[model samples]
Target: MKRRPRRSVPALLSALVLLAACVLVAVSAIQRILGERAWIDYDTVAATLHNLHWTDLATAVAGSLLALAGVVLLLAAIVPGTATVLPLAGRFDSGVARGGYRTALRTAAAGVDGVSTARVRLGRRRIKVRIDTTRTRPDGLAETVRTAVADRLDRIGPATSPAVKVRVRAPRRTT
Candidate 1:
């Protein structure tokens, strides 16, 4: 089974805060049970609770907010993180890091003659290559770039081969 990615920074920080709160509560409970000086004052807490009106709108709003926070934290922990790497075809588990595939595609496109520059974007189901060429006839340039990018992707043998879409643009003339 593939391991889930790490949680986001905010999720991790929230978890840490929750852990610390639990530890503090546990320590306080132990101290109170052992007749030692507890960090929290039980008398004050009881008095505050008795004074609060449970039916008040503020109490209801506070309770709702607390419930919503718990739900958000639970969702963060249960949901799988976003995928940042594309899986490669191989006997063992292998993946190409983000931007690696783009770089490879760009290099392959740039290797073609007359190509001044190449920009590539790799998506889940499509690969878009934008090429700036100095060649007069750009009619056939798109197909050529597409073929080159397709061949490069085939060589890499990723789990899913994205369809290649090539766009040829004329190079800007400099005075």
Candidate 2:
């Protein structure tokens, strides 16, 4: 039941970064072997490391930052992402795109009578519909919108139907 998106982008990014680092180090080493100055001065870095104190504020801060970055990358790789599509009831491999489903529900809600504007929010287990109308007597408009939305959801046919809630904004009353 775990429907997570692929982590191709992260894997590609990590590979590119590692490749770049390796290329830089190899190029510097090749230049040094050919009796030329290295792009990154390995001798100077070694000297600096030997002379530096680990208790220094700058060293501690840099180490902390590197450690934090490693932890963040680890978490990003391990965490599962949310599913972009919703599963249908019938076929195991068939599913509907979330954006398309949301658009359909919005259209259904907007098509209802007395609904001037409709906003539909699709959550993991709920669909909330908020509507505004110019009609003064919009007593049954909310229920009508709810029914329309529910019918549309049934038509689309997700594996588990989310609960539909409707709210109607009343027009201003004048004495």
Candidate 3:
């Protein structure tokens, strides 16, 4: 089973805030029940709520913001980010980093004649490569890049070979 990435910052902040609130409420309740001096004054809280009439707009905005935050947190916990590692086809459980695959593909594609630079984007089901070349006639450039990238992918022995798409573009001339 794939594990979800933890949103540590938001989760930690929310936990700390909830813990602090719970502690404060528990402490005040215990003190009040034991006939000791309570930290929170119920009369003052009641009066403040009773007299709070003009601040409804502010309260509504705050409530909406809180609801939006809750929705974001929920989505973050439920949604998983793109897989960073691709599983290899072998007896032993092993994988390659997506960055490593992309760098290798870029180097392989750039090695083609007339190709100045290469940018590769590797996805779960496809590999997109954009090649820039100074040559006016980039004939068969896409085919060359496609074959080279496909061969490299084959040698990597990933569980599934992603489809390769190559786009060749002329390098922009500088003044």
Q: Candidate 2: lDDT of 54? A: 93
Model 2, global lDDT: 0.87
Cα deviation of 143, candidate 3, in Å: 0.8
Error of 3 at 76 (Å): 0.8
Point out the higher-scoring one by TM-score: 1 or 2. 2
| Model 2 lDDT tens row, 1-175 | 3367887876788789999999999999999999998999999989988987999988999999989878877887798776777788885678887779889999999998788899888787889999999988787888899999999988988899899999888777765
Inter-residue clash pairs, candidate 2: none
The model with the greatest TM-score is: 2
TM-score of each: 0.59, 0.75, 0.71
Candidate 3 lDDT tens digits, 1-175:
2223458878998999999989998998899889998899767878977876655987778888999989998987778777777788888888877778789889989998889999998776989999999987777889998999888888888888889999999855454
Report the lDDT of model 3 for residue 32: 82
Candidate 1, 1-175: lDDT as tens digits: 2334677775778869999999988998899899998898778878987888989888899999989988987888787764577788888798877668789999999998789999987766888899998866666888888888889989999888888998888855554
lDDT for model 3, please: 0.84
**Candidate 2 residue-wise lDDT at 114:** 81
